[model samples]
Target chain A: MDWHQLWTIISLPDNIPIVGMIFIIPFFTWFGLRQGFANDRLLEKLEGDPKLARAHHRKTQPFQKGWARELPVWPYLLRMEFLAVVIVTFILMVWSITLDAPLEEPANPSLTMNPSKAPWYFLGLQEMLVYFDPWIAGVVMPTLIIIGLIVIPYIDENPLGNGYYTYKQRKFAIWTFIFGFIILWCSMIVIGTLIRGPGWMWFWPGMTWDHNRLIFEINRDLHEIIGITSQPWIGIFGGLVVGGFVTVAGYACHRLIVATEFTRRILGRMSLLQYAILQALLIIMLALPVKILARLLFRIKYVWVTPWFNV
Target chain B: MEASKKAAAKSAPLATNGSNGSRQLLGVTVDPQEIKQKALMDLNAIKQPTKTEVYKSIFRVKHDQTARSRTLGVLSNVFLHLHPARVNRDAVRFSFTWGMGGISFYLFWVLTWTGVLLMFYYHPTKVQAFRDILYLEHDVPFGKLLRNMHRWAAHAMVLTVQLHMFRVFLTGSYKKPRQFNWSVGVILLVLTLLLSFTGYLLPDDQLGFWAVTVGTNMARATPMLGHEGPFGPQFGMTPFNDVRFALLGGSIVDANALLRAYIWHCIAIPGFAATFMIVHFWRVRKDGGISGPNRIMLESEIKPLRR
Candidate 1:
């Protein structure tokens, strides 16, 4: 086919924005997994080569006086540091001259901007606001993330893969962080920064920003779909069901952990407290995708909604 | 004639001896030992002549290519204390650390220098903040360059700090005794983000104002500390007493917010981060410098070896 025909074929799903998912999601997923395998192979090669491994160990062995080398820091580190700083300064100077930082009109409280956004760093949390209550998405989740990061070194028992690149040895840590940083955090930021347009709607690359064509989908809560009445008994029953769902889900995850020797070994390294805390955090993270799926499939805005709180 | 010439040469020596005797007779006694000492000093000076004493005293360190002086030079100098006398050869490799940690430090220094200069031209007040920026961009000589450098350096610092964190994580540099340092690094990362965020509000332009608005609104959702947030009533958090209240200094982003951002961006957060950064660097050295290339021996690896 000619270029025109190719363009037309690609443009077929341009109007149907979500249809872009067919091209993006699987492509990135496959690419990510392939890259992961490639890394694993590279790590294996480095690890398996006896001569290379011996040389590496011998070179670094003297420094094992706690991960340091006896080489003088002055000429070595200072020279490197000085060179990097000079180059970086030059680059920054050039870039700063080339582009001006963005400036918009003065702040008007009455005129709320469409697609109001936080700084790029917080765009992940901003995108999370789309799926959950602000309290949970902005505060609780970020707090939990900080806590989890602080506690990782303590909870992680794997002593291997330190000071070197070894994907096979620290696969879980690597993949988990990648999934969080890349898929959850960075992807959301990219989406928030670019794909999101007026009214916080997804405006794909090929599409134009048309405010008139905005589509509003009224979402229903899970309780509303189940036709639960606002009676005292029903409220109690609803609370019970919610509690039951959590307990069952937690138990199922616990069982799955022990069901396989592979998984059991992973958790076997942690104490009961660490395991419980980490598993609970994992479950909370798992709920994010589940809630998104619920919204996509069933048009459920929320699983829980009450006067004081909503989730 | 030959006899007369010999007699004249002998008279010449006698005349030289007679002049020396007359010079001594005038006053000062010259010891033979003193004369010998002067001759020896001159000989020693000739043997080890000074070629670059002025340059050496001013700039060149007393590095005699010996271990003792090298260590002493680094240890004695307050400025050089930041670096150890020696580092792991691998540690100096750009690919190993990606020079990111060092770059972050460089950017921090750049920001500090440019920031102090910018402060000379900037006013944190709402009325003058935007005007000051415009004046700096258009009126003052090299003002725009200084501002741009500061802005870009701030952005660069944030990015480099993140990359540095990623490098540390990937290399598993945070393992073992480095764990506590890792936690401190995490705090530094947060401080970096905070510094960037606080700085975002400084320009008082639309981009900054709304960014600060949206960013601080998240603080309002903080569990017990925000007036509109969860558990607010239990904590008796009003718009006056909430965390967001303390952050913005009010319910809305206004003069107080601008001032607060200025204080934080310019002073508070940097001070906090700098304090941690000192600890971070000190601990890096204390923990035996940047991590080496030794593969972390996990329990699984050890089990195989034991078997």
Candidate 2:
């Protein structure tokens, strides 16, 4: 591509190229390489190669005695800090030159933009507003996220994967966090910032942001799609559906994961409250995938939409 | 005598003997050791160069492999206390920490400095805000660069903070004694977002205005907390008493909202973030310098060989 074409693509709205530089490409590289290294160590351990294991130790941990090498922070940590500063300074200078920050006409409350957007970081929550009402998407879900993030450390008890980068050892935590962050959070932000256009319609990359055009699709609630009425009894049945699903899924997961007597005993050691909270979190996480599928197959807008709230 | 000789050797061997080692600066022979000793003193000391002691001080500590030197090198400095004196070799690896935290801190400083400078040129009012930005572009020298730097640095800071949190999670650094610090980090992350959001409204441009409008409208739907939203009137929420009113100081994004954003962007949010950022870094040291693969790797090394 020509330099002009390349620059246009690089500086596209949401700065998708910058995202790759700052996150996407680097994340996969680090994760992929680390996973490979971990596998190699596992293989060496399995093969009973004492020398290879020692070599691995030497590569990862040079200090034979203590866990740390006791290198002075002056030139080690501080040096890295200096290097990071220089590198960041260089990047910022180039970015500042290449793209000026967006400055539209003076804000007129009377004349709203075609598709006004929140800051890119909040696009996930904004995208949630498309699927649910304001209360649940804006307030309830955000509050849950804060509480969930804070409680993670206290809830996790398995100490095998502390202070390490072992994918196999900490698969549950790693995968769950990745799914929550990349899929639920980052992908939604990408969609909200890049794809959503005038009148909040989906626009592909090649599509123009034409205000005159109207995008149409039928969006329905789960009850309507399933041929049910929105009466009190139907609402109760809907609640029962969710409750039953959770119970069945939780039981099956327990049976599958807690296979041995030893494993069951270990799980039984957890406090009742912790176990309950964990099950609720698992249900919420699993519900996202189900919600996405429901939307795709039946154009479901919300699974539960009460007078006060929607989910 | 032996210690002095060793210190001299460590500081500079060939320099001590060479004629070029000691030079005349303004007709005075400049002693490297004396300069080092003077540097050891606190900032309060304002003695003349000649008046300061010529003896070796802690700052004169040359390149030595002793534990005390290593510890003293970090402890004796005012700026270095944020970091542990001695970190594990693995902790300083580029890919390990990814230097995201450091980059975030650097970007914060850049934004703060540029924001302060830009404050001299820009005003917060609706009438003056847009005009001030235009003036900054065409009238004020280097104003464009300063504003752009502040803007981009704000964006970069947000990105880096998220990346730092991701690294911490990916490495499983937020566990046990570090749990509280992780919560503090979460607060800092939220505050970073808040800081960036507040700054977004300062330009008085259409992008920021409509963004603030759409964003604050989301607040209006805050259940019983907003008057105009779904469940607010069911409770006692009124136009004057709702959370949206509390945030905007009125119903709409007007002069009050703009002023509040300016104050928050300049002072309040940044102040809160700085306080929490300090705690976050301090907790990292207290919980053991940047969690490493050391513990697990050591375990693997010590484990009996198995086929």
Candidate 3:
């Protein structure tokens, strides 16, 4: 193992946030879900006993008979805000003092940075370029992501978990978000930052980024593999394959949506339009990982190719 | 000390006698001892600064431990008034909310101040930009620290903003009345990313230059607008007149791109983000404060679909 290579990547000042995210995301996930599970257990107890449910405050937080249910924001909430600011300031100060921000040589159009990457946050999009065309990965995907996030509240039909954390109550919503954010987005960024090296080649952690290395592999379009070599016919066959994949994925999503009685009820609340939008977004989201696996395992590049675009 | 003691002794009886010890000066009757006592009372009020007129004028509320005073303490101040007079007691707990939103705002404030300071030493021209950064690192006092803090806080802001969105999603805080605010928040998230991206190009170093080069290169594939995008050529788009050209102000990352990035980073985007933030916070209160550590509802409570 090239420990020095691994250390060099890890110790790069710009990568600190990703390293921090590796720990922070998991810690906060556990922290949040722990509370969620605790609330679920309490919910079970309260649901079984009607009398206690009536008397109970219904929150996991401790409450006494004489205590006020609300507190003034002045000393109570403001103090917490002040403390958070002070703590953040301290962290930033220490970080700034210890590590210097990166500055390479002056810009020269003649010389290109090998494996030139975008900012760490945009690294996810950069990595997406490997699997799809720039139009899809760069333009369309970002626009869709923002639109999908904006429409989340309007589309989510579940009402049980509103204003509180509960895995049992919000199983579908929580799992979908975890898959999108932690698994897909964050993991891509980490991969782009640490694993992808010179020439955008994949190097396992602790492996040297050998600039001279080359891999001899041939990637083929789905139609090419199927031995079709004509314009309209090739386009028709690829479109059929894409359509089939979508139909199958849509059915799977439908099954998952109606998996439990609670989920079925939630699904019932959604309008037909809402249901369609949700399915469309979910299928597109699922396509990312499916495409990544196709390229990695099977050397498949494009499933669908047309005069205008390839997918 | 002797003069004050003699004056106190002389005024002692007269102060107690009230109007009887008053003497005429000009057309109005005036008492020196009474004036002395009034001045002493004013001095005492000054000692308790909160009771003074200047303090009261600014605060417009008492600082006592009473509920009314406490409520007014937050409601009266322009900065603190963004918060409600009171909040759900459980909402104050760190575990409930995680305080990421507030930390994100604080980091923005830090970035703004540090950014302004760095701007004083920076130049957006092709030749001067790199030298200015070099000068900042080696010559300017604490300039390295200033630039470092700005960069790190920016990274921190992006992380905290994501975590804030994650927490909001995890708690299902975007339901019902909060749907619109959540949309506003998504816009703010985009603005935050754009702000950071624009700032990346200001140093004119290879790292930023190439990062930006790779970034703006994506615009070259924006279907209808970019030259290399599908059908873009059919629509008469080219390297000189495409969306990428508009973004970079030229065919390549050059002096014009640096200036454009500087303007967007320092002026335009911050303005938009701040305006959106105002709406976000306002809607948060209108939507009934922070989505809470509330009682979990049961499955049986699910209402039937309308229509």
Q: Which candidate achieves the best TM-score against the true structure?
A: 3
Angstrom error of the Cα, residue B117, model 3: value is 1.4
All models: lDDT? 0.72, 0.74, 0.93
Off by over 4 Å in 1: A1-70, A231-266, B1-60, B63-70, B296-307
Lowest-sum lDDT 10-residue window in model 3 chain B: B10-19
Local accuracy of candidate 3 as per-residue lDDT tens digits, B1-307: 9999987766553223345777654435687778999999999997888878888788898878999999988888899999999999999999988998998889899999999999999999998999999999999999999999999999999999999999999899999879999999999999999999999999999999999999999999999899988788988999999999999999999999999999999999999999999999999999999888887787766677676
Candidate 2 on B1-307: residue-level lDDT in tens?
9999977765552323346467555436787777877776734255433333552453555457787776777787777777777777777777677778888888899988999999999889998999999988778988887887888888778788888888888777786668899899889888999999998899898889988888888787787788756679998898788998889888889999999999999999989988998888888888876777544543332233132
Interface root-mean-square deviation, each candidate = 4.7, 3.6, 0.8
Query: Against the true structure, what is each candidate's TM-score?
Result: 0.80, 0.82, 0.94
Q: Which candidate leads the pack in lDDT?
A: 3
Once model 3 is optimally superposed onto the true structure by TM-score, how far is the C-alpha of residue A272 displaced, in angstroms? 1.2
Query: Pick by DockQ: which candidate is best?
Result: 3
The parts of candidate 3 lying over 4 Å away from their true place are B1-46
Please, what are the lDDT tens digits per residue for candidate 1 over residues A37-69?
444565565557756644444332234445544
How does the DockQ of candidate 2 come out?
0.35
lDDT of 3 at B127: 83
Q: Per-candidate DockQ versus the true complex?
A: 0.31, 0.35, 0.71
| Candidates, ranked, DockQ | 3, 2, 1
Candidate 3 residues A206-283, lDDT tens each?
A: 999999999898999988998999989989998999899899999999999999988898888899999999999999
Off by over 4 Å in 2: A1-10, A13-29, A32-68, A248-269, B1-70, B228-230, B297-307
